[model samples]
Target chain A: MKHSASVLALAMGLGWSGMAVAQEMKAEVIHWWTSGGESAAVKVFADQFQKAGGTWVDTAIAGGANARTAAINRTVGGTPPAMMQFNTGKQFDELVENGLLNDVEAVAAEQKWKDKIPPAILAATVRNGKMYAVPVNIHGQNWLFYNTDVLAKVGAQEPKSFDDLFPILDKVKAAGLIPLAFSGQKTWERNLFNAVMLGQGGAKLWLSVYGDKDPAAVKSAEFKNVAETYAKLRNYVDAGAPGRNWNDATALVIQGKAGFQIMGDWAKGEFIAAGKTAGKEYGCVVLSKAGGGYAMGGDVFAFPKTKDANTLKAQAVLEKVLLDPTTQIEFNNKKGSIPVRLDVDTSSMDVCAQKGAKMVADKNQQAPAQELLTPPAVTGAVEDVISSFWNTPGQSVETFQDKFAAALKSI
Target chain B: MLALRPRLASKLSAWLALSPATTILVVVYVGCTAWTVWISMTASRMLPSSTFVGLRQYDALFANERWQISVSNLVVFGVLFMIASLVLGFLLAVAIDQRVRAENVLRSVFLYPFSMSFIVTGLVWQWLLNPTYGIQAVGRGFGFETFRFDWIVRQETVIYCLVIAGVWHAAGLVMAIMLAGLRGIDEDIWKAARVDGLPPWRVYVSIVIPMMGASFATAAVLLATSVVRLYDLSVAMTNGGPGIASEVPAKFVMDHLFERQNIGLATAAATSMLITVAAVVAPWIYIQSRRRRAA
Candidate 1:
């Protein structure tokens, strides 16, 4: 009887080892992609991870700030998820500095990300000579989407410069249509200001103000021009624009009630959802000028530091699956963004995405978005100034410039 | 062996039972408040560090235009919200106390909004106040072509819109409290007023209101706390927009704390709020305790 019991114990041990070998690698991923298209895009990553013998647990929070807050709190509270999302910026710098995030340098080196990823995004994701996050997609934050029918009806040429834009806006207004579809929320207001700053003030001044933190650049004549131009747009927007959501504003353009909207590429998702095709039903312009800069921002996932071997393995699997070439195309296509790796084929994407990809391919025109350039605190402070100036019509451009300079200086 | 006394044993057990609550109050509340105070004096960003920057964050907070606007807006919102809610709620309670038919139904209808959250309240008010599709457009659709009620989108008058929504949400709760207070009052007081030939309005204004001090204090304290933590309403309604027109101090602190990653500035703002509330409440609390002792 003793001999048989020993044999049974050995058999049980063998069975347990076999089970461990085939155990599913489970990972909890936190992200802010809760919209229909965004969820569909995130599902691509989940499916690929599942196929690779990993479990993808999703904890989706709706707002970016809320999701990041939850992820950061979880990390600090020592109940961290396997993977978490952040914008492709310096948002996760504290996590990295505090040794709270796991470095994915192995995957980055294996994939030759240093060579493939765009320089601006590569610089943003890399810190202290190590890759702390994986760049997943590139979103152009300064696209001007206009309704083709409205423009054609008004006999307005596609605007090629700020000088050209005013005439077109005037014509659209004269035609009894809302010239600009605008959301008066703070973030969207900031986005509109950034578009004007980039398109009118040009890349040099944009970099000096946001990147180099040059106070003089903010107070410069060009920046004053940009401020005036942004304020001028107030006349074109309807009185009901304040407190409107970005999608609602986009809906106005889609319904042909408005002529133009300066928004991000994600606005394309709304237009597509409304059964419109890019370049046919609506036209997308990165900036008015041909060589204008495209403000690039996107999302990335960072692995939290974990002592569990299984969770570590899952993180590795997620990092690998997220950047796989096929997964990039599938994910970005649904996400209304271009692949972070410029080598991906653009044939399947819409014309707007194709245009963004082409613009990103030219390294000279790739300007980092404000989040990539400044810390969120500084960006928020400057946003307050810009929005206040934009809403208060009586505020002079000189006062706006001084306040803008002071805001940058506060950082 | 010596036997323990029954009273001593019970007292020891009571102390043991109360220890956990005392510990939590000290650690979670007092300890965290102290930590926040310490952090506010430093130039902490993203995460709290031990770097001392003196009163620099406070200085910056005082200089911020948005912060200034948020404070003034809070004052306007708080005073108006408190007065309006109390008056409306008292009136509601008085009306319902007249032995009305379907008393239960009337009470619940008056108290329904208190059951809903501030987020729901804000969203409902947002829709109702929207210019393009809400009341204004509805009025225009009904042939009132010149009807205009777009205050929610305007900067100067947005706080009043918030006040309207705030009063609407809170008056129900106040009504319930006032009604409970009125129900608890002695029947003898009403009989005495009638014997003295006092008019109903005079009795209410001069006697009932003055006698319901405890209920008024209760409702006022509840309303005051909500005023300090007026975040979700502003977030769901205006998002501190139409260009920072409807921003409140709590929203500013929250934005700086998490989204902007400026913990020092956020704590500075939070500490300032705490100090202001204490300054306002400390003397009143002292006077209340003294009055109770005298009584």
Candidate 2:
């Protein structure tokens, strides 16, 4: 057989995710959430679904790309699982178009999913006027996490804007700790670069380059300055960052070894797992004062078409359990995200998640995850350029500006 | 009916009986190879669509900082890993032939890696190689401050880490194969060498090594297959990071096929890989058949 092409190519050989399900309606889901916290969080859904008279089969694959491949292959191989997870974006657009996915419109209509989910989140799950996936949780794609002790050591307060961020980063560096605990993976590097562009370059520049592909905006002096500032972040990371995992980078901030990590809200889970209190041991903030925004992405489960009547029933049951408001809150609470339902109570969530929930609740501050704006291929190729510049000592900002503009154009 | 030699007809019938497997081999292997080559000629994205941009992907593949590095890395890894495993395997096989103690234990130690899937073992190697969390960290704890085993992070030497793990997984199986060949050898040769006072190393190197040709061929084919299919190790260990320094062709093809969704470029890469293998193996196989014919 022709082998698969995936970043999480069981070539990545990491995750296979079922600690909780392997019992009821016998639904085997392949997912990438194999980390300690992620596994525990998914347990909520497993338990709830089993209670509703179904069997759960956990095929716990660690990386997202790996899980998707296994699911896709099995679906094609005539033994499709009841549910498979995907990031709420355009990733599964082709699957829907190819008629490989079963629409959950029956469940969506009954739950009035349209009114509960934020518009952007709903748009990602629904394709061509039909709901193809069920949105379970909302992940705040961009949030700034800082070591309160490290910030205090450097006499820096929570930075409200990118301008405020730069000086504080320098002060954190002067305090003899890493100013930014960056893992330096291509995607993360590009994300940090984009964050700075949005926070400093502002939304217009962000959209002009990503949405409009305006070569003029890319060639501007402001774009040059954004590149320079992103380049500045290079010096803040430690030498051991080239292949460091994102969680380990967050650990540096948690242990007071670093001052900042402009990562997703998932960093809070690492902090909480380490027994650190948010806003006390560590503090949270989002940059960009033109308006505060959360780059929104979330997890969704899609049903691959199955011929077995039992599997079909299990699929429907999984959809109902995943979208139930109570199950949604419990799952997202442990997952370091928020319920997709804007109506869910936020009092029980951690301080950082509360901030994210508040951001989603306010219509003015919702920004889509970069996945919504671009496809996986373009993002990955551009990420390569970003990681290269961040790692190489002599890469010029001007050269990078040219390459970045060209990358967006070509992709 | 015209009378024919029964033996000749029986031989022909035997070949006829073998046609199904051969047909499958030709169509599945040969058919896919042609499709792969054709796709490479296109500029297909997520799916195979004919948007012929002749040699654009090839140009990109060549100019790609990652692809170039992948070639060099594979060359280095393949040469060293192949030679080392063969040498070490032969030695272990010869030693085991001398009524060695705990043969099974040592054999299992070496052979177990091959049996356990590389997906898991590659992960294990990655963990063991990580400087902070693995052996280096443990060594420093025991008062070895001068310890410096950090190949996993270095751009210059990380491929060798792959070589190290690969050899660990392969040498044992090679040993078993070689042992079988060595045992099949006539005891008369060893007895004659003893009478002549030829040293053991000399006897082994000059006569025994040369005689174990079939085993060497088998091992070579096995190792070559592994080399071509190399993916799990690089992905689990470094993921072609530190700026595309540790990239491999298989990993590149994989990124295109699934992650990047550039199926055309992936098939192009696959097609070229197949061609390279054919270039090397076809001639060898032809010459081998000719030799067998003469024998």
Candidate 3:
């Protein structure tokens, strides 16, 4: 009787294992969006995937460099995750070239992504006439956020150009408030310099400098003015600015202790977390005189190649779910970014996000951020030069221009 | 019969015990180092491939301003951290060896920092040194409104902050080693010095230090290796910043390898560091071996 009972249990276990193998579609995804807002944003995709009969396994790493390193190392070691996240730029070019990633042309064609996605983002995700990654949202990298009460207390109007912005900064300074709440890290310093380049030098100069890698453009008189304007704003920041995190800088503006913070649209997440509504508690403007030449960068998920049928099916499901119109809206709403699809209804988002979505809809106003234009190596080297110039007070503009040109030449 | 074959069996067991470590040393250590040297000569980026561009990466690395700054900062940090830790460790060891009560507690308290990782030490020091919410703020709150201690935010003096944290983390280990050496000294030597009318400080400076050569060498080599691999403390505390003011060689290599996606340049930097360490260490090792053979 004991032997017979054991045999029956073994038979049931074998049958359950067989059924599990045939039906389950599990995907393990590695990403670097682990913050409160970012985690909520990623859960939207996980829920949508689950509702579509797939199991989502989330592996969240905190920093972008760390996550990419782990993902690439795992891919090389032959135990790759089903999906991995990278910046929506040339970061994944090597993965695609090495045949480590699976192309999602089937989903792209089925969803009519070629028409729905913006051409710039589509160009970034596509290489060699194949779609190897899926872009989820667009983040504007050059938005100027201001506290409404502080600006009103100082009787300052929103600056329409860099020329008008400086006097406003001065008034805030004279009113015993920090004129510009700035984070003095290298990346944030580079972000501010890029904003100045676009706002003061225009898109033509930006394309010439970063796109063409033109030595003449770096040495041009107009570029000198851009550098000077960026350097001039260094006077407005407090001494405690060095090594401060971006969110902490945003906090100064939120607490009405500062007038302005030039950061990305992601700053809106901090404001929302602090219960401050956009356009009332604070305001945002993309600093460009040419309507809105918004500087754009974003996140993308690329599927790693796998021969297993179950994993491939799971990848297909994820590719479709990420670009679904409803998923796009829900994900970007939590992420504080505009949806990648131009046709999504963004009216329910904050006023800043709506403005970004409207700007992205117009092709003429879209300027690719520096990461999309140049590789990380070149961008990082130039960032070193810019940060050094900003911190070293006695460094001249000519010396900075020479160093900037030299940095570009090395690449 | 078993007792008669014991020597032969012991010889076989010795070889068996040593084989695994030897194989690992040859394959993992020597093999990876050789592979890195070969890759440094190529123009690899984002991934390693065999497309040779001999010496160009080295030329670029030498010409790069960041690399130059890192080399200079490493020198400043290495010298200061080594001397400061040695002096502090020796003093602590001597103080704790004076037949004090609660000896075990004192030893553990002195050695606690070494048990904690450098990341934790760096973070603790970073908070204590921060201008807004740290020592400076506390000082100002005490009615000293003009007090300032913001070296971590200044370009010129940022590297000293790293030196401070590095010495604090390492001095404990040195103290443990030195204390062991002190306990092993002959008790008759102290009696002899006391009968000869020699002062205790003089005996320590002139006699005891010269006899503790092995312990000093051990502590110096340990501190030297830490200085060469000093990446995490700088990363956690200042991140080579206030604008590349405290950049070190290991951090530069790592940033290029993973973050910048320029593996060729990263490997080239690593190779340069390897050559420098070998240049400094090879002669010392050779001289020590010769002295041992002569003795």
Candidate 4:
């Protein structure tokens, strides 16, 4: 029975993943990619690692935070897995400081990651002038996904900036469709607000607040305008927005009951689930008011230090397969992110993804998500302020601005 | 000495027999509690460390808006839920004791909910409570146009829906316990009541209800623990949402301990809960012991 399952797992390898190789080296990878598409994408890595004579022990927790806590606990308890994922951001900062992670400098050097991977990504993966993690795919945060049928019925064109976004939202309301589908969970609320900030307040405001943590910048009239824009979006959402999952909101757009949703590129999963194709059934662009660029964040796997020789070998194989250009393309194709490598092919990717890849290829257009810029604690604090202002009726825009400035300044 | 096997234990032997249990109690229960209390004082994050930050975590904790909301929501939920459960439970028990036909079937009707886990029931509640596809829309579909049952989505009324679900999940256990107490009553009570020419309701309310002290005590303790350890219902029902209108302490502790990666704050929350529980339960224990002594 075990042999039959192993054979099935081998045949199911997407392209170059392991069945033959995995039999030799066993590596436990703890991650949070448990949804259908996410699991399918992860299987690519597992298969590739297996093909390379390494075993991929998949321990997938459902939620990102749940997985991280488990991984952190295991590492601290001195029974760490071979490789575990962290967002390419400040989440692993404490762990790195605590010396719980092993430097993946060897893999970086082997893959010429410094040359192939984006500087933003490399910078995220590297801390203190040493590589400590492997950068995988880049998920374009802040994409505006819209149902074409709903938009056409309302006789509205795709809005270029958020100014164009509002009138269309009104039209969507008049059409009796959901104006803007929003998931009011804290993380996504913050995501939508940040998208508005980046699109409206522009890259400079984003950098100052997150990258520089300049309180003065957060207190500026520009920041106030961003806060107002973020709050203005509240009126367009349905009453059922609060506590809804991102996918549920995405489902609204997919079902054509909602005209639009401002979400990450990963929202493409919901569209795909409904058998809708991008550019044919739906339209997408980065929902920037200032027309800057897509905000990018993605997954990264860091190897934990281990005494087992087999574990070390498995980590090496997994790293190789993840960064291998073909595997990157195949994985991200199913995963809905651009390949981490800039020089990858664009022919097979959908139009929106191709656009994202092109924008990423251009040096001036790539802006990292706050994950790549700030600590989760700081992001969580800002999220609270954002969600509060968004949810509460009769809330003063000025009060929101002040609190927003305070949160940014403190961070 | 007259038995087939001689009795072996004396005072020294009894001590030997009890050594394992005593050691386990000290090492497992007391030791874990002490460890949690100690960790509450430190500034640990993803992992435990030796940095003593003293009440700083707790200070931050109290200042958190969500935590304050959780405490308030819990107070409202706990009181209303406890009273509603007891009342409904007692009524159901009394109804079942009226010598109705299909008594077992009727009891099962009241008791079946207790057999199911909160996770399954919470989902059913969530689906049934959802505005678009649930009771509200269904009622509207049936041509009752102005129907509005959106308490699940509203900030103010979401807690009541939670109470409704909590009552459904819990009241059954209370009924079963109360029913046992009711059934154990002697026929002499009815005879005495008849001799006095008392009404059926008054006899049951005055004489029979007071006699069921142990049943009420058991039910209160069980429900009180559920009220304090109310993580699953909150999670399965509303997930502390519609902007945290339904947040509770256990969910807060579990979230911080695992998701937030702030073990210090989580432990602090746990220790505070332990203290509160101790304060309430200690006096009850004292009263119970005194009653035992008097008996």
On residues B79-172, what C-alpha lDDT tens digit does candidate 1 reach at each position?
9999999999999999998989999998998899988999999999999998988899999999999998999988889999999999999998
Q: Which runs of model 4 end up more than 4 angstroms from their true locations? A: A1-23, A401-411, B1-21
Please identify which of the two predictions, 1 or 4, would achieve the higher lDDT against the true structure. 1
User: How much is the lDDT of residue A143 in candidate 4?
Assistant: 87
Ten-residue segment with the worst summed lDDT in candidate 2 chain B? Answer: B59-68
In model 1 chain B, the worst 10-residue window by lDDT is B1-10
Worst 10 residues of 4 chain A by lDDT: A14-23
C-alpha RMSD of candidate 3: 4.9
- How far does residue B49 in candidate 4 sit from its true spot (Å)? 1.6
Q: How do the candidates rank by DockQ, highest first? A: 1, 3, 4, 2
- Ranking 2 against 4 by DockQ, winner: 4
Of the two candidates 3 and 4, the one with more favorable lDDT, higher being better, is 3
Model 4 residue B5 distance off true place after TM-score fit, in angstroms: 17
DockQ of each: 0.74, 0.32, 0.64, 0.48
> Compared with the true structure, what per-residue lDDT tens digits does model 2 show for residues A1-411?
344566546634432233233333578888889988899999998899889987677888877887877887777665677889988887777778768889999988887889988987888888889999988888876688998888888777788987898898888878788888988576787778878877777666776777677878888987888788888777777756767789999989988888889888887888888899888999988788566467888888999986656677788888889978789888998898889999878798888888888888887677777776667766776777777777665878888877777666554
> Which of candidates 1 and 2 is the stronger one according to TM-score?
1
